[model samples]
Target: MNTPCDIPALQLSERSFGLLRSLFEKETGIHLRGEKRHLVIGRLQRRLEQRGLHDFESYCALLQQPHETQERQHLIDALTTHETYFFREPAHFQHLREQALPNLETRPLRIWSAASSSGEEAYSLAMTLADTLGPDGWEVFASDVSACSVWQAIQGLYPQQRLDNMPKGYLKRFCRRGQGVYTGQMLIHADLRARVNFFRHNLLADDNKLGEFAVVFLRNALIYFDATRRGQIIGKVVRHLRPGGYLYLGQSESFSEPLTSLEYLGGSIYRRPSCPAIARST
Candidate 1:
């Protein structure tokens, strides 16, 4: 299955690009094409240098060693994942404030930030929900595959720089500027922090039934998977959504074929058809 293009520029040998591609593909169902030869080398070359690996063969050997399990995860963490900011897609939050939350009558309204990289998306949700439902009525569940991101979310501290995308008034209201020894950081308000639960979870795998949620924000994460894998992952996550709940994808994504049950409300929003079974419970 190896192709000539998979070979690297400096190395005449087949190199470890095949092994790297296979590893990421297995873990995340993300395909690394043969043409990405330079990209593979460019991304991981620093890791090799840090570990004193002179060639791709040596890197592959290290990855195969059982003790290097955490190292492999570090590799995937670096190669994939994107930067997310508070209100990255501003319109979604606007819609939630003006439209969605007003209609829900359920107690303890649940929302899932399914790909909440580094907690901004989840915190935004918590802030809006707190504004709407107040202190006692709602909760946010935020999760990501990276252990590092989950830890950051739990700590609830961020560089003041990361709040650049946040609105000035909203920022002042929800965040506290670090002082003295803690300068240059912003700490999330304790109220918002308490409303969110952070955890490490891979969206490609089945998660334990935390609970059926009223809304799910899987945004921007599915673009990494191949089309077939995208369908499967979407289906699995949708199963956890309560009937009539909402699911939001990145604005760039649109479903076809089997996921047609969701009614598109434009701009990446979809509504799940209400189930008769849930109607009886209601």
Candidate 2:
């Protein structure tokens, strides 16, 4: 009997927000501050409506119940941000093409797009590697904390607007323009899609089943964490980098702690010392 407009907005009290924030940090390593209260509420309102929950307290209560792992994951999916586009921070790709690709002795160069949301960064890596190293000479492993995002990356589809920043020849070579019912979307060419494997991975977890990489792209994702959490994540992810390998961060982020094993390479890049002893000893 109640009209949509008649229902009041869900109220998230200070206690509820604190509890939710703590849980989110514990699970995802993303620190939500007091400032992000509105952002959190905005992102989670749909979950409330979907579950027919009346208030934030009830949603919090639901999350606390046992065997709500799927619900908790849904909460994470709702709260985590996945804003990304093709060839974001073009300088990183340029450096990879001109500097990193040529220096590696490894025949089949391995690269990891550590937080490859929606496949743009991963696809970009594939394009560059495919062009530089040829199809069989390179491989890409892309992973994200959000299963929804991992699935999206696997699909290799995107809206036309997302490709605005993509490099000039890539669209023609590595993508197919959708037509008919699928107009306004683009799909990464099947070959390129096959080259990049997508998976669901939590950076906070210690399980490193993906193995080592010559280049690891951990870009634009560290801004969400605090200094300590940032260090924790960086330290954990750096373990998977092969000796002498490169790690790329967003232009805006910098390491708060001195990692003696990694030499500062400038341009928001760091290189693990080429000496195997350094990596082994660390």
Best by TM-score: 2
TM-score of each: 0.87, 0.92
Clash number for candidate 1: 0
Off by over 4 Å in 2: 1-8, 276-282
Ten residues in sequence with the least summed lDDT for candidate 2? 1-10
lDDT of 1 by residue, 1-282 (tens): 232555344452455777888887876678877887766777776677788878888888888898998878777776666589988788998888887777666878999999888899999898888777777888899988777788788888989998898878778889999999889999999878988999878788887676788899999998878788898888888888887788888887765544566667788887777854423210
Error of 1 at 255 (Å): 4.4
Model 2 residue pairs with clashes: none
lDDT of 2 by residue, 1-282 (tens): 222555555678999999899888877899888988878877788788999988899989999998998888887777888988888899999999998887888857889998887889999999988887777878899999888899989999899988999877989999999999879999999888998999888887886577889999999888888888788888888899988799999998865666657877788888888885654221
> lDDT of model 1 at residue 171?
89
